[model samples]
Target: MASIDSKVNLSTIPLVALNVTVRKKLGLYLNPKNIMGFSYLEITNFENFKNPTNEILKNWQAQRSEASVGKLLSILTEAERTDVVEDLRALIDEDVRKYIAFMEKKEDPPVQVPEVDSCVPRTPETLGLTVLDDPDGLYPERFDAFICYCQSDFPFVHEMIRELEQTDYKLKLCVFDRDVLPGSCVWTITSELIEKRCKRMVAVVSDEYLESDACDFQTKFALSLCPGARSKRLIPVIYKPMTKSFPSILRFLTVCDFTRPCTQSWFWVRLAKALSLP
Candidate 1:
């Protein structure tokens, strides 16, 4: 680094010459352990290199001299250069460090993305988190939710899921978290499950729900299935603040229009109470 830092790419030949020397010197220590000469072994050992290799490689490759990223960082005032490699050696050193760490962590079983705390960011596979197998390898034991709403109503339905989990309603409520990976592949499985085995349906209604494909499918499914053995199982929760009026079909069920209640503190209590009763 000291030998090549100032002259890096003032001439490419000097930079290449410096890297060859560094790589060879690095190989002397690395080669002995693997029984090959001139092998570039990382000083901190492989175990330390486990988890972050690809990310580091990505960062390193992103900073190589040919890239605009390197040029941009080079021009920055010292104080402003926060997320940059600074120079090629620093980038290489970072990659070597990450590579070593990744090797070290490699055998520890891939770290799973932590279980999402609330179902706000839930997916069919993620919500169906446990790796239990069906003969079909589809359904997990506990993820039975039917998310019913218009595409237009997902904004409110998005907020409603957060509020639902605050209660001990016990059922796994799935209002697709808009903030998670939007447009994820998991929706295909969710679409299948809702079409097949869902019992409880939470419909976030606006006039849009009455007009939309998602609403038409879910509500018609609910109205047809939610009777006799099913009883009054469909919960039509209103989202629009402008209107309290419901369509003649939906007017019969007890409803909570989020219009005023969503703004008040007691709304949570009332909402909790309503959810608690049925």
Candidate 2:
């Protein structure tokens, strides 16, 4: 039996990870927000680990130190704790590698005395895009995140939009559906509109979603637009059981599953964290 002090300590896990078998056997009662979701920890780490680089492994070690694994395990069952911890460690490793890469690029010598060519006619507007960026969201202009999916997947997209909207994440999700453009413009304007807008995209993976080429392209474009093209920015919401495999591009993202509600509450808590909401 876990005591109040134990519960408090478990709940205080720096990173959110719930043990399934432990919860089943011990009847752990955690705040609903702390539920777990599919993460990039395993998939991402496996992708990077295969290459076996000293620097990558070192970065993983650093991120692991940021969170307490033992405290994390004490909160869940043996099995759950082990699985979650291992996965979390993998993701931390990937992040560390990315950080190192970024720093290295920053430290590299700057090219000088190089002649620059202007291919196309440029104006202040083109230059203004990079002008003093606001820390707060783009002031009724740009978005920090954008949820994009096929029109067929509107319901799922809508639900996710609603959930995110309720949180404090400072981004406007341009959810495109029949509702956005009801009439004749639906077919003619969808592709142009979706591609032109949306900075970060969330692809809702479903049976119907894969069946459409339009959707495939949209997800692809969104993935391309992602900064550094890291996996987390473009989300994949797994709506059902699947044998499908994502490309290396998307392999690193945390898959948000709607399959098991009971086990999925912690994912929402991470979403809350991503949203930067209390």
Candidate 3:
């Protein structure tokens, strides 16, 4: 039987530099059983490099430095590097984070109906006269209403949807906070779901809504569907007092005023009637 030699020239070899012969001979770098001449073999102990915990993984993902990631990669073995890189990539991908944010924000409950149906009959006559007349049927209505509002006005929109649902008519609303799915592109969702499908666009008008780029985008897109000032496709609901700062395009449209306590019922009735719900 032939025995293999595992001797190394210590004078020239540095502990950090794992020469081919050393790597091949000691595949297991820090085996306690191996009486390798190096006294500080513990320094290269592979066990010391255990997989990071969820917290540490999150921290690494949060860091935006490519150089730092490269430094982390260089220290680990090829196999370990692959796993770490994958985990980090999954943790830090922009779309993945967006998906997570979408999921967290989209917690509103879906509309529910009572066990016994409401007596109010669903008929075309119940819908207001100002509602859009779809004679040509150019665009199939995807949602009862597409809600456009700022995050600040989300509470109002949320409550509004709840109120609308309780009425005889069940309003199918595309409220971004509740409608947009995880991993979906928000812009694409807006274009497909709100711009194309919704019969009416409901703008929760407020100072914040006007200030928000997203809210403005939805409002303008909805307006683009109906060019003239008399178009009933776009409905404005006054969530806050924005009379002074109201945009010109929205100024002409008949608005449902929920800003005043006295007009709150009127606003609800107006919106419900516009949606064809008795």
By lDDT, the best candidate is: 3
lDDT of 1 at 1: 43
Clashes of each: 14, 7, 1
Clashes of 1: 14
True-vs-predicted CA distance for residue 227, candidate 3, Å: 1.0
Question: What lDDT score goes with residue 266 in model 2?
Answer: 71
Instruction: Give the range of the ten consecutive residues with the poorest summed lDDT in model 2.
Output: 130-139
> Please, what is the whole-model Cα lDDT of each candidate in the order they appear?
0.45, 0.45, 0.53
Model 3 misplaced regions, further than 4 Å: 1-141, 229-231
lDDT per residue (tens digit) for residues 1-278 in model 1: 43334433322221222223333433332332221111244322321322222212222332344422233234332435343333344645444444345445755755686656652434444443222212122223333355677677777655666565433443345554431234335444444345444545666777666666656666666666655424555666765653535666666676655666445666545554544443
Candidates, ranked, TM-score: 3, 1, 2
Span of 10 residues, lowest total lDDT, candidate 1? 10-19
TM-score of each: 0.40, 0.40, 0.47
How do the residues 128-147 of candidate 3 rate in per-residue lDDT, one tens digit apiece?
Answer: 11112121222122467888
Please name the candidate that would achieve the greatest TM-score relative to the true structure. 3
Q: Which stretches in model 1 have alpha-carbon errors above 4 Å?
A: 1-135, 138-145, 166-171, 176-192, 195-197, 228-230, 242-245, 261-266, 270-278
